[model samples]
Target: MEDRYSAVVDLQGDSKQAAEFSAKNLNKNIMLEVENKDENELVDVVREGYLTTNSGFLKEDVNGGTCCVTALIRKGNLIVSNAGDCRAVMSRNGVAEALTTEEHMDGKANA
Candidate 1:
């Protein structure tokens, strides 16, 4: 998470704040879920963070949206966790490879 994302720099009461909520909480929730030892825990945390943070923003009547990405490299495995439009990509032998494709705000795979 970026330092500026620590909180909403400007209280626009808009989606930017909600996006900050997503980024900040994604950092927090991922740590909370790490102990589950589940392979998909990162992704699950991202999903939960998205909902929980947005819920708070909505409860406060803040408008806007959030998107996030999470990834873990463990035991020689590259795990990609994507939520919203966040994506990951890599290169192999000068070839670019997409780890996750961009999707709509609803969190569905791109068609």
Candidate 2:
């Protein structure tokens, strides 16, 4: 059996530092807090992860960030969340299924 994990953080405009920080922060929280959590608890963890990352941004930083996270827990449950334009997709039997919707600058879903 093989295990795979993927997470992404993309900052709006440019701020590579912000993106890096958000990614690391989110990954850390997920690694520490997600095990044995239910779906609702997983959502809460993701939301709090975003809040913690956002709180770390400098006051003068105008850049925003997008995040897409996926996790496979025990019992074969997969949890996914998207926090901006970033998206998550799954491939099954040569077909691609979008797991998340993309958000535009106006905060509209680009489905």
Candidate 3:
């Protein structure tokens, strides 16, 4: 079997208190439940992983919201899921590839 890897970044409200709370409650249930290797499964894993890692408190501001970004790398295949403005990108052979599209208030943005 090939090696599998995962990374997560959780960004909460613009205050230290909010960020702290968000990180503390970040769930990791998906990592403990995923087992398939298909594309849909990979996407589901990425989505659930992000949710699990970014659940917590938030601030009361227009731009101050909680967001999570997740990346899953299995051998040469890569999958990513993101919320808010968080982003994930991959580079191969000098070519840049977008792993996760950013979710911004303005719309989807490139990372």
Sorting all predicted structures by lDDT, with the top scorer first, yields 1, 2, 3
**How accurate locally is residue 98 in candidate 2, as Cα lDDT from 0 to 100?**
89
Every model's TM-score: 0.60, 0.60, 0.49
Task: Give residue 33's lDDT in candidate 3 (0 to 100).
Answer: 51
Model 3 clashing residue pairs (backbone): 27-52, 84-103
Put down candidate 3 lDDT per residue, 1-110, tens digits, no spaces.
89989874444325555455445543344456555556557656655554544432312332245555555566676656666656666789998887775444333312
Worst 10 residues of 2 by lDDT: 102-111
**Worst ten in a row by lDDT for model 1:** 102-111
Question: TM-score of predicted model 1?
Answer: 0.60
Q: List the candidate 3 regions with Cα displacement exceeding 4 Å.
A: 1-14, 21-27, 35-40, 52-64, 103-111
lDDT of 1 at 37: 58
Off by over 4 Å in 1: 1-13, 40-46, 103-111
**Candidate 1 per-residue C-alpha lDDT over 29-107 given as tens digits, one digit per residue, 9 for 90 to 100:** 5566666657645455555655655566678665666555666665565556565656777889999888877655573
Decoy 3 TM-score against native: 0.49
**Cα lDDT, model 2, residue 37:** 69
Candidate 2 per-residue lDDT, tens place, 1-111, comes to: 999998756534555666777677766755566676675676666556555556665453567554555454545656666665577788999999988765443532222
